[model samples]
Target: MKKLLSLFLMGLLVFVLAACTANENAGNETEQPDGEDTETAEKVLYLNNGQEPTSFDPPIGFDSVSWQALNNLMEGLTRLGKNHEPEAAIAENWDLSDDGKTYTFHIRENAKWSNGDDVTAGDFVFAWKRLLNPETGSPAAFLGYFIEGGEAFNNGEGSADDVAVKAVDEKTFEVTLISPQEYFLSVISNPAFFPVNEKVAAENPEWFAEAETFVGNGPFNLAEWEHDSHFIMEKNDQYWDAENVKLDKVHWAMVDDTNTEYQMFQAGDLDTSDVPADLSEQLFGEGKVEVVDQAGDYFYRFNVTKEPFQNENIRKAFAMAVDQQQIVDFVTKGQEKPAYGFVSYGFTDPSGNDFRETAGDLVKTDAEEAKKLLAQGMEEEGYDTLPEVTLTYSTSDAHKKIAETLQQMFKDNLGVEVQLANMEWNVFAEEQSALKFQLSRSSFLADYADPINFLENFQTGHSMNRTGWSNAEYDQLIQNAKNEADEAARYDMMYEAEKILMDEMPIIPIHFYNQVFMQNESVSGIVRHPVGYMELKWADKN
Candidate 1:
């Protein structure tokens, strides 16, 4: 299986993590039991989630904010271990057919959900079928398209009965794939593949909405969820491997501001926090910052259906105007690399070359070329003056600063004045998903370790492709890449697809992401997989 090292090795190789989760009235539960030293009775870690998790439902909580916490509270057939490779979790072991398109997983004999029900093979079948059901409306549904009939079912062209997954027996779960997926094991480690308890979910479809009803089968259990304020997780004694679990509890706060979070960290309320951009240099110079590697890019998308951006030349002009290098050096001021292509570094191709290096720079940055393109685009549209442009971003001091910098860059490089707008992450995410914004900042963390994971997002009508851009050829290339059994040929198709995406200019590359944060030295053993999300299972406080 491909390891998370495909995400690039910066410092620690262990998938390190820190505390997080919602707290309802678990306030009393976090208190120490009698006679134990109040300070030493329970090993508790407090951390921030930045904002409320979009949802707790396995398939529904697709974003990092939600998946990071869910990663601990729920167990998938496989889980990314401290080494960042998929290891057996609910499924004790699995076998692959000689064709490499079918997988049979063996469930653990002692595996039990938080509610004490067996983590059965039936649960996996039910959850996976739910994901492919067109009525579920899950954005993460596309991730499962590698499964046979998943695409047809999700696209409403087939029924759930057509999906090639089933419980062979109580302990045996089977899944057949449409093709040979290189990252199948790693991909299934994503929170979206976690099985939902069949009985609990059938009784209460809204079981994931609150702490009282959530029944997870991982290292931790949701003991309290007070919504936007905070949430709490207590260690699950029922976990199959609970004997090895370290942390007793985790408290996750939903504060979105980095500066405020840093202050709370300084005040000792938070065990860890993201380094404020202003303090990044100071912290790094003091040897206090940890540069966590991530396989993803922080970029911007242009809604091609919106005015001005509807012109390809205009979109390219705007994309070429902003210097990604300058933005990384001045605005983000971290250990991030400026992105020249959609895919970030460290994915080793079949021939053993980094995919990003192999693809080279697809995005352009020539100021003169940008100015000419802008003028030509305006002339072609017969506009006496270009339409007013607004750059939208979510609520983050970092996002705001980057937007301001981009606005200024447009003014200086192309002589185009642009307005800036910001909204809370939820509102911004919803608006962007609905194609309500012309130009907006966006980030993508690889759901799995593969170049195709990054390149597949621009396909026509894909949930990730909110830009309203469509190219039949590009879509076909992605489809071909997915089905191609030869790794070399598959990668070549992905390379071509990326080039086509850049040529269309529906998006601008900013910088590749790295999780730059500070963790108190006293905390240890948190596992943060580079594919995406953190695992608090092995975390310990002193």
Candidate 2:
């Protein structure tokens, strides 16, 4: 009986071991509800886009927020890379003429628009002509001025046929430049140069305003646009390199308030958001902040064509009254450098010296001089006291703080009563563009790593020159610099132009911008170019 019990126990032990092994194997083979064997789920990247994009039509969209969304939705001949260098996009390769004034691009056969239409060379020709057409009213039409005959066409001296872009074949596109611009390739990567589908645009001028009608040719397609709340973009299966794209979707929330956006980020509702200035110190201490030296300037422009501001003394007085050091140190929390000039510090001259350092301290605060100038300006305008002027800024905590500080400085040092006004980004941009305000906040991010980009805005009739301030000498200097072959001569001409700009004071230099933002550790492969562009084509949430 004892021997029989021992055999039974041994059999039971073997059976128990077999059952446990079978259960372990079954658990390892478990599948998702959809029967997919993948261990991870589809990834979606979330971000606070800062503001509602004014427009998605590439030619009409000029602000950073608009360009950010457009960059994901469209593909130009080239695209900005990690170092802000030009990388081939729709154009597979190109051949430069021996004279360096012409480029012949070979379009990729696999490139297709979101609607499954092949992106032909004719599309580029049509787009270039459309951008230069005065009737289009694209603020960025000046971007095409580098192409041969572009300026003449834009100025109504020539017809669209006179423009030097041509399509030799369905796959071959060519462009002739009026001059050899070293940064031409880099400039074309901007959204203004992206191709537009002639059929779609002609059929409906408002196509880009709606997600369903917007046909893009980039890594993502606009799936939904909820005006002030958020927008959703999904992977574009038709993109040429779609196979390599990592994230399945991207959600851009339009959150203007930095504090609220940061709160959402902390709650894992956002993958990235700009850090509020007040919280930068704490975030940096916690090793959660990323700072990048930006090639941009934050400044305010005077309506040079309008009352009071028409007098250069008033503009100069306002420029000198505000203490830039205080704004940078206290308001910005030392995240930015005090800008005494329009051009930021990241750019370098041909000799490798910093541009800002080269053009040192063109403007600075002087309470006494500012007071005297204010009195003189009012006296010239035939008023014992200065009239109440309104200062306008976009809706943001940082901007509000800066505007309030400037208001206080003007009242204290110059005895000027300045009213503060705040508007949403879209409205504020329109107000500035229409010259609807006395003084307004503005900023310029480098389109390319050249001082010319900063100075080009003030050219006569330039759309961005909202100040209506024109100087023939300034225009001529820029032209001379463009034509100059000697590096030293070009830089010398630029410096001279900058001096004239500073002395005239069409815009008040506030501070040079530094990119201050936060990103979660789970996000990877995001690219922030020094030129103030963010690219997320390769970003993954794993």
Candidate 3:
């Protein structure tokens, strides 16, 4: 009996020991790092960018899409905030001269580029000079022309060294302007003023085109780029404020078709996508759409250098024939407001009055009056019948709808046959820049909140003025506005400039844009500036 009791005790001891060991192993497997669960997935944001970026190089990127990506990958001396106010980015603080003609910026010592290079004042000097270099052919070079001697250098009449930008020290950058610009701070927030690493750009001209060579000082860095499909950006560990950057990674998918992007958003593939015009109403009603009042305008420019468009009466007649209200209501589904002037609504003058309201409606649609004007124009041009006009737009379902609507309107109202053409975004942009189309669709988002931002584009020799229209009186008014110190006087001069622009009819205003996009409920903190660009630094994926 003593031997049997001893065997049973030994067996029980072994069984208890095995059970404890199994429990210990299970506990070890369940243990997490830092006392947090290990199963938590990585935070990521998936966005459909709508079109491929033209260039990530700051000086060359002038379009909205390119600016969107560049705004993430690069940091300027200042950044635009929610209300289009200038906020510090690389420059910790700045000083403006009493006359406001000079600005001195103190670079942040903690700022570091993705490649570990210290971002310095010299980078700003080099970037400004490079942009002003005529050989660069930067479309945004005009943005730099506000600086003293900038225009002269870009015109190839002055030496680059004569440009008024200089580095006082490794951390101090100075810029001298031609005159006191009220919106100078806001203007520098544009990507055109972003600094570039001199060493990287000198070594690789195609640095921005590839992931290996691209280095930026923003909150994110390029990780992988699959041409025409997508690109991924990982959080930049070296960013000055990386701790506050909630997203670990961002994936931008290039899906040009709005319907495809919407489908992707529905399928859980895209966290955010551009809302198609047809679906905007439905989405808004469902509380799935974000409507932003953008400081921009959607319009079509007439190539005044081209045959029939060269006639002022022809341009005015066509401009008056189109019913802007109908297009905005039916085509954009009332998402946008009919624009009668070049400057968009929402911008307030110094007197606290809306600029658009001050500048009233410059043009109005009257089908009967339009027919009379067209008859008179045809008589003046000594043509029995108007020539068939071709209108061009970028490839997108919304653009196609707008183009078709306009085509039908011209045919029905004026008895003029119209042809339509469409091309990829990049191709269309290039063709428009080269002035290769008779009539082409275009839009301009304000670089700043000032009326000069819109009025300056139509200046006599401005690169953005693809219509080949020029008037000395209009140019004088813009110059006067720049030099006018009194706020009321400055506004008066700008209003006159806009009047001239409307009378010339180089471009017909369609509607003022309201940013209509959709985002998943879980995605939050994606900052959309009043100027219509997305800031994703504070964005979080829940």
Candidate 4:
């Protein structure tokens, strides 16, 4: 919320050309009939996952680490194409009812999983029901609430049979939505909507737990997994368009530290790595880093049930104490714009205006005002001395640096000495989601290219709302937007909801997420979607 402060620290979609083949068989070994040496080399791409995937089960792996890999290992009815728009994948095409609430998809007859099982429309019905099944407790269930009766089923108010998804035939999948959604096609491209192998799952409930048991219909198949260490994906020759998948293997390492990952890249162990904050200046100066637009936010959440943060005024005070411009300029140094609002800059409204631009700044920087609010909050709590505050973050060199910067900023602006604590990502994520932290780091990558996707996270009981934050008016506004048929009216509802979310101060806006990385010259065709995910169908390495 603080727009400017003393520089204390520190920080696209990038479209690479698609390479059709490898470089002169660099790793080949063979003797031609004429005594010429010749052989083919494996086109392997090495990447760092930054952490272990939350889960391989499509519905359960809702975060970046898992979705990044899942996107390659599975396909939904529709998938994001190289242009960052949804295109037919497993479902060759679909017919939308004139009223627009019902959709009938025609699955490709040749689509097959790695195990050679034909992908059927029933798989979609099974996966969708599993996602909305209250017993499954899928965190991404909210993403499917667009479907008619989806919310009711997930809320335990209705049976799975109540959900409006059905396998009309072996190849026909039909779904009825609560209302017409402009982003439905794009949203389904998310991993939460990926179809599961119902046959494999029925025989082995834990089919997704190990490489041997895993099955995928995407461009790659899980070949090896070592839990927290690394995993490998080999090209799935059974894929519908396997000929287009250029990479032979994808090796993913769970390295949380960017500096270490960068070192690995320099050592040729990885093909690409995040530009470390310390080296951002150098890498950027050398023009090795490419910054691409992404739709999402990087922020911190306040657990409302926790002391100090329990007071709305105190939450606002803490938020106002942050100098986001300082964080991006010196700390992150990734050329990201400081975020003063919840929604990222993208989504064009029916009026043809950027949602973020039209919404304008929701909060401002005022050192005096922040201090006044802190005092008033303390008075409201009748505290002789405010309770201690702890700022928590998951393990990451960059996150730790940002947390430290926040610590100094709070001290400078509000005279609050906030302690710092951290844990590995998996543990930190679980604890935070359970509301075990007073204040912790959080991020939101758009599930679709729409403003509502950014605004829906704070709804009263949404799984993404880990801050113990609940606002009835905000929730109603979101619900109204979801049901509103008028495009102009829907945009208005989202704007109002976002404003209220910022006013309540359950979260502090830091900087919007972006596709900022340094890639190898030898690697190409790895498309980074503006929706903040990678497309490696055509990725290749020499």
lDDT of 4 at 196: 96
lDDT of 2 by residue, 321-425 (tens): 989999887888747889899878876788999878998999989989987887888889897666679999999888999999999999898877899999988
Per-residue lDDT over 328-400 for candidate 3, one digit per residue giving the tens place of the 0 to 100 score: 8888774789999999887788799999998999999987887888888888888897877899999988888
Query: Over the full model, what C-alpha lDDT does candidate 3 score relative to the true structure?
Result: 0.85
Count of backbone clashes, every candidate in sequence:
14, 0, 0, 9
Task: State which candidate, 1 or 3, has the greater TM-score.
Answer: 1
lDDT of each: 0.88, 0.85, 0.85, 0.88
lDDT by residue (25-53, candidate 4, tens digit) is: 21331223542211123466889998889
Candidate 2 clashing pairs? none
* Candidate 2, residue 492: lDDT: 89
Best by TM-score: 1
Off by over 4 Å in 1: 1-37
For all predicted structures, in order, the TM-scores are 0.94, 0.92, 0.92, 0.93
- C-alpha lDDT of candidate 2 relative to the true structure: 0.85
Q: Which segments of model 3 are wrong by more than 4 Å?
A: 1-39
